[model samples]
Every structure is written in structure tokens, then in C-alpha cells.
Target: MSTTTTVVDIAPVAEVQKLSLRAADPSESKPEGKAPEQEYRYAHLLPHFSEDRYPPLEPYEHVDPGHRALQHPNPRSFLDTAERVIEITPQLGTEVRGINLAELDSDGRDQLALEVARRGLMVFRDQGDFINRGPDFYLQWGRHYGRLHIHPTSGHPRGYPELHLVYRDGKQSFNFEVDDSITTTVWHSDVSYELQPPGLTTFFLLTAPPTGGDTLFTSQVSALKKLSPQFVAFLKTLKAVHSGVEQAEFSRNGRRGGTVRRDPVEHVHPVVRRHPVTGDEALYVNRQFTRRIVGLKREESEAILRLLYDHIDKSADNQARVRWEPNTIVLWDNRVTAHSANVDFRHLPDARHGARITPQAERPIPALEGLDLSA
Candidate 1:
């Protein structure tokens, strides 16, 4: 693979020709077995409440959790203790083995934090120990990173407001149905509309389907690096407006029983953001939340955003797909990655339920060039 960091031509003729000439793989069809009807494993954990019962939380500032990793006395010590640390891809995604997240010492936690910041995502399997410890431990572990963010609209489990429930039943259909077509994939950095967006996000699978229900992640750093430097420079000068209006509307329309704990928010973030720990540039605008580029006409912003979205979606080299299983956890730095849930098993009766713990981080900062270190 080319290790050059400099900008290259976008989709050269040779590359196009090579892609066109690629041999097609033989199609193997497997019969879809009937999935047994099942109830959500952690349904008991969910709280019963009316939509108007949740009191609104006041907006507040948050400190970036990555700061602790930066100040750690020994940031790389966890790698020594792990049985193996496999980098899944050259750009992003890591799988660490032989370490239980529940028993992590302060140093181990700090090191893990550093590793997550360096690698865009980390995968841990057989996390039964951590999962069995329950939501109290989960919330505490997340709080160690930063202030836990209570989602404005999502359904959370009872007694644990910090954990956002990602649950779906067989009876419900997705709202994206347009003329009998359902759009399942929506790529986004979680809640980018917030004044302080999520930093490190933890998603723990309680019950996964027999097959399917994988999540897609793409490295924004790699996405930004692929563009020409001139284009990158132009993007760095711009900011995009991210709004939670659509999400709030979805909640209010009885999606989650008309739950709206807090009002929807809107904020402008840089088109290119600088990761606080790695100092890498990442293309920060996302399709779900980002509405328009600041200071641009509606059509102009749409055109530019459409181009960037296509770049992100078409970059196969920069993406990773994570297959889920029960007792599995995937943690990622929300600042540098955009993720989408694969709802391939939507038609099936098998349930895919998970809980996410997200810690709000510092305000989005632009990845500007020509910094004066002397100051």
C-alpha cells in the first residue's frame, strides 16, 4: 500500500480501469432460516414512564476526556498486558485480546483511552464479565472518561439515564419508508449538534441476531487525507450547521412514545476538525446531522455537501465493518469516525438490542494550518 501522505489525484483513469477489470466473485446463496421469536434480554432494565415525566436537563460544558490520556504517566502500558493487540486496518480499527474491561486498573483504563484515541475504533469480544457487571459499572466506567451524556430523545434503561437504548422490535417499521422502500443506513458522528459532542462512545451488545446486524465505521482522517490539499484547505475554512431537529421530531412523533427530555440543539462545527490527542485532521461534517455549510447559499452548500458525502461513502479503503455478537463491545473515538448501523436484519423477527454510553467532550476545534507555537 502507498504510504505517501500527500494528496493524490481523485479517481485516476488507471485506477478506474483496474476497478473495472476486477474479477467478479462467485455468488453463494444461503437459505434464510426462520428466526425464532424472542423477547429483549434486558427488557426488565427499561423504566416505565410517561413522555412528560422526564425533566429537562440544563445545558453545560464538558472537558475533553482524552486529556487524561495525554497526561498519563504511562499511556502504552496496557498493550504489554494484553495477550495480543491486532490492528484490523492500516488506518483504523483495533482488536485487543486477553483483557477484561471490567478489571482494568487506572493505568490500564488510561492506556485503553489512549489506544482508542490513536486507533479510531477498538473491538473487544467475550466481554461477559463487563456486561454482567450491569449498568452501574457501565456508567461508572464511562464517567471515568468524562461527563456522561444523557441523550435528549433516545429511550434509556430504568435507573440508568446515561445509557441510551438502541432497541427495535419486530412490530415497528423504520420511518425512512419512501414509496415502499426503506433506507436503513444513516452515517453520522453521534450527536454532532451538541455544543460538546460525544468523545469516546461505548456500545455493548446485549442480544444480537443469529446473523447480520453489523455496524459500519469509516475513518474521517483517511477521508480528509484522500482529497487534494487545496480542497482540504478550502474545507478547513468552512463550518457546517448540525441540527437535532429531525431526531427530536422523530421522538415527538411517538417513535419513542413521544419522549423529548431536552430540546433539540443546533451548532456550527468546522468541516475539518483536529483530534485533541492525535492532532490528526478529520472531515467532521456528517450526512445525518449536518444541514448546511455556513456562509454558503442553499444550493452551493448542498452541492458541496453532496460531493463530500459521496467521497466518504465511496472510500472503501477507509471503512471497516464490525459484526456484532452477544457480549461484544465496540468503542470508538467519535471525533474521528462516522458510523452507521446495518439494519440488514430489519425484516427478520430476531432482535438486535444494545446500550450505548457516550461521554460528552470538548467543543469542536478546527484543524487549522500555520499554528504559531512560539505564542
Candidate 2:
């Protein structure tokens, strides 16, 4: 399997590195005698969210008395401090308690990188960044991991080119022709059409509804593991066409602003991918971006894709849900998990908005257990 270099493969190093980050003023007031770090602060925006929107609540603070929480083990990989991690489930999802997502020191940044790998997604509740300042902190969080990824279609935030917009107005619908029950709500790994897709995608939920704006997650590792050995071996022999254009957009309801590139970028990837950092194998197919299996009849490809989609998405046991709170941050590895943000609140009164940060792309490398990934 020879690899070809595409426009997506080569990123502008000089252009990306030269990008400036918004920082604080030397004359700005600080509490007591503390000093400011070199990174960006709340210089660009104001605290606009009303207090009633999202009351910053602590973990178990809002819970009823005598309601016990799940006891979880300390986080395993890439953690600078296990003391902070509170695992939500054995499969995936966790909250790295008692830390400010809006700001992180050098050591804190390193711990975050490890934490993202250990727990497929790390949730930070009641973050100051999402509440007050615009996407400045979110941009810093992205650069802390790697070179920030700029979306070709999604527009950037004001003064912050690194941050992408992730907003959904409940007043609108993708396909008004069908029932709200039949939505384009299929689970997907973010931007899988790119040969080198986003390594990590972070979402800072600035405004969540009074009820029902939860996002679902499933471990692709768990999905692949569910299949038999014979099935796994057979899948490794196939490749799939992944495109984020018209076909994929329909699955997503439709693109924001209804802008579509006539010739959208596309790529081919293996059914199995090895994590660049963790080296774990994951099922790479998703109903949203993956179009068809290569070298197969259209009928054969659709049948297989449908089967794989059901296996990964339909199983609740392999999944976890994050009920959103205003100022909540959820960062997940695109290499290992598939996620779907629920639109159950579409007709409801509340509106949702968030700033997204995606680190540099990780070229998908195929691997399987007991087999050499690079042949």
C-alpha cells in the first residue's frame, strides 16, 4: 500500500508558527502579588454570559444527599498527576477535577496531553474561559498540545484564527422534511476525510440548555474488540473511501450556512488504524464520513458499511454520555473514539454555542494485533 502526498498532508510550518497568540498587558492588575504567564489571557473579550445561564457547580455539589458516585481507578497513561482524574466509566469518559481549563502552566499542559490519551475524553466543568473570555484560552489549550488546526470551511473566531466555530441554533433543522426522530445524528470521528485528520478535538460548551444537550461517545477500540478474530483479519484486507462533501454532509443534517465546496477533499484509509501515540488499534469506520469500501460492488460496500455502523453505534455498553453544563470542556482523541452530539433540544428554548480547538492532524496508520502495522 503506497502512500501519496496530498495538500492535506503538508501543513504550512512558517505560516502556522508565525501565528500570534493574544496575551495580557504588563500593567494589568493581578490579585495580591501573583504575576501573569507568557500566554494569552482575557484581553480580547468580556464576561457576557448571564449568571442564570449556567451556575458553575462543582462535582457532586448539586447532587442529592446519600447519592453515591462511581468509584474509579487512578488514570493510567500520560498523567502528570493521577490525584486529579475521576474516571466516569471503564470504557471511556472522565473528569479531571479541580483544575482551570482556561489556564495551565508548563507541567499542567504536559499532564493534559497524557490525560487525553489515558481517558479518551477529559471533561472540565465550570471553566472560567468558556464563561468569560472568548476563545483565547481555547486557542492556548490547543497550542499546548500541538499546532492548532484551522478548518477550511468553518470560520475562525474574531482575532483568534486558530479557533473554529461550533454552534447549533435550536430554531433551525437540517432536514425539515422528516420527523425530529429521523435526524442526521450519526456518530463520527471529526474530519476523518482528511488524510491526516485532527489528532485531538476540544469543545468548550459556552451555553447548554436547561435540559437535554448531551453528547454520546463510543470507544472505537471497544468496537473493534467486539468482532471475532476472523472478522478482524478480513477487515484488515479492505480500504474505504472517506469524503466530507455532500454525502457526509447529509448525514450531519447539512453544513452550517449551507456553503458546500463542489469538489470537497477526499481520501482513502484502512478499516483498522493504530494510534500514533498510544499504538492501540481502532475501528476507523463511521456512518458520517466513511463512504464505501474500495474494490467492492456498490451493493457489497453499502451492506458492509451498514453492518459495521450498527455494530459500533447501536451498542450502549461501549458508550458514555456527557450531560453538558455551561462552561464545560470536553477534549477527545479523534484517533480512538466516535461521538454524536444530541439535538433533542432543537425545538426547545435554549440555544447552544461553543468554540472548538483541534490540534495538528495525525496521519492514520493501520495496525492489528499480532501483525506488523507498517508492512
**lDDT of each structure?**
0.74, 0.61
Regions of candidate 2 where Cα sits further than 4 Å from its true position: 1-84, 129-133, 159-161, 173-181, 247-255, 260-263, 368-375
User: Given candidate 2, what's the lDDT at residue 313?
Assistant: 69
Count of steric clashes across candidates, in order? 0, 1
Look at candidate 1 and give me any clashing residue pairs: none
lDDT of 2 by residue, 147-175 (tens): 66545444344455556655444443222
TM-score for each predicted model, relative to the true structure: 0.83, 0.71
Task: Supply candidate 1's per-residue lDDT for 7.
Answer: 16
TM-score between model 2 and native: 0.71
Cα lDDT tens digits, model 1, 246-291, are: 8889867765545678888788888899987778889998888999
Query: How does residue 212 of candidate 2 score in lDDT?
Result: 78
Q: Quote the lDDT for 316 in model 1.
A: 84
- Number of clashing pairs, model 2? 1
Q: How accurate is candidate 1 locally (lDDT)?
A: 0.74
Provide the RMSD of all predictions against the true structure, rounded to 1 decimal.
Answer: 13.2, 15.0
